[model samples]
Target: MPDRVNDTAAAYCRIWAERGVRAWEEEWWLLARDIGDRIGRLINAAPDTVTMQPNVTSAQAVILSCFDFTPPRDKVVMVDMEFPSMLYLYRRWLEGRGRVEVVTSDDGITVPLDKLLSAIDETTLLVPVSHVFFRSATILDAKAVIERAHEVGAMVVLDIFQSIGTVPVDVAALETDFAVGGCLKWLCGGPGACFMYVRPDLNRQLQPRLTGWLAHENPFAFERETLRFTTGAYRFLNGTPVIPAYYTCQPGLEIISEIGVPAIRERSVTMTSYLIAEAQKRGWSVFTPTDPAQRGGTVSLQLPEAATVCERLLAQDFLVDYRPEAGVRVSPHFYNTDNELSDLIAAIDDILADMN
Candidate 1:
């Protein structure tokens, strides 16, 4: 997490101690919507079209609950490289309602666009794919996927978790039906704060069944009759909003908004390319794409005993992660320095030599 987040958290505590319940009416009520506006600015979306949710999974579930699973439009399409949570949600939730069709990755690194496109036909209802694959950091061809899905009358639910802060995403330009992501990774906003962007037109047409009192038009009225969903993206909210999470997230969002994603992307590309070239020079395999445009801020370098190496690196103050298929995932963000990347590679070499 970024240093500025500490300040935000402290501020949250101050507000909690000082105002207590009264703060909900004075300062806290508009927080979720305000955060939505910040996210909308980042993704080139209209502020009214975005809303803050607890996490990507719940945001996706809300989107999934909106439609009935029957007739020709009953198949949901996704790629194998997608984050496993969505796949799990679709497979379990739509057991009898619909079927999920996952397009497999050819080499366990990236999905073939043609194979995925073919899977989406008139029978397809929703296509939930990642903007950048979580494990490989390989960016998908979002435009082509959106076009193909729309062509076949299928709605697209884009998971932008791996790409949002480091990658430039124009939701307005993509014309996707829904986009979901969290502040945990690239956004540096920490956890428990995710967002969903519904295309304004679609937001008007769909009503989610998996909803709570917060989505009600008159939540304070406490009428015990049929629920009336609030207009715009608040309709996706369930129960009470996570107010503290929003407080912790705002500083990171503000920092990214000030730096601008395009500048961050440029810095990321330079650092990741350097890291990949350094790894390749030592005869290690790179799981992420070599093409700068086809990748995000991370580079997955395969090495001997990758999990152990990751543990060693973290012990030495190098913050990197490892996955089952992707080894030694090193992500270079805007705040990272070029020398730090070089030093990390050097440390890995030292660790491996010692292990040998």
Candidate 2:
């Protein structure tokens, strides 16, 4: 762990000490609101356009369930490479009513944006895509896809879990109708905290079907007859929030904001580039894009014995993850340095040579 990482964690500890558990009070929905606002600011979106959620899955469900889709126009488009959560949610939506048409990518690992655009007709109500392919770390042209979807009067929902803190995103500039991401992984926010972005103009248009007392305009009034939804993106929040998790996450978010997204993105790209170069040098097949512009923090390498390799790497104290389709996935955060990546590559080389 670097001094900077420790310092940032310490700062959060100080915040927790000063504010105590009372930091996340019912009256202080402003704390949640401020976090969302900061996220929007970091992503170059309007404060009113952002909302806090329990997780990305909850946010996606809220966005999907709210849309009024009729036959033919009831279709939602997604690529085969999407995370299982998104696919499962869309499948559940299709079970009784609407249809989910999955567009197959040329390579099963990457979604072809053109194919996705071609699949969207007027019948398409929403075009949902993962900003970065979880398994392969393949980056999507979210801005272009959003712009194209709007041309056909379709709403674009982006699952930005893999790219949220790893890559620089401008929700407003991208013109996406809805975007969902969590604090875990790159955000380094402990678990269970997520954020959603809903375009301000589209807030009223998209109603919340999974509403709870918290989302009600006047929860304390206890007016059952009159269920008034919130005026902004906050309406997406379904129930009481996890105070501890939110508090734990605040520090990580603050760290990213202060360090700056552009710098973080640059470091992520550089680290991944170095790892990819080293893997290629070792004659390993790389799954992630060679171009930094088309990649995120994760870099995948092809190895025949992925499970065995992953287990060995873990035993060796090198942190990495495994993806079924792409073999080993190495996701290095900005706090991680080139030396750490070099050490990981060296370990991989030794492991492979020993296997030979």
TM-score of each: 0.99, 0.92
Task: Give per-residue CA lDDT, model 1, range 1-356, as digits (tens).
Answer: 87887888999999999999999999898889999989999999987788889889999999999999887779998888877888899999889888899889989889988999999999999999999998899999999999999998999999999999999999999999999999998888878899999999988778998898888888899878889888887888877888989988988998899999999999999999999889889999999999999998899988899999999999999999999889999988998887888899899989999999
Candidate 2 global TM-score: 0.92
Best by TM-score: 1
List candidate 2 stretches off by more than 4 Å: 1-28
Q: Give one clash count per candidate, in the order shown.
A: 0, 0
Off by over 4 Å in 1: none
For lDDT, the strongest prediction is: 1
Q: Candidate 1: minimum summed lDDT over ten consecutive residues — where?
A: 230-239
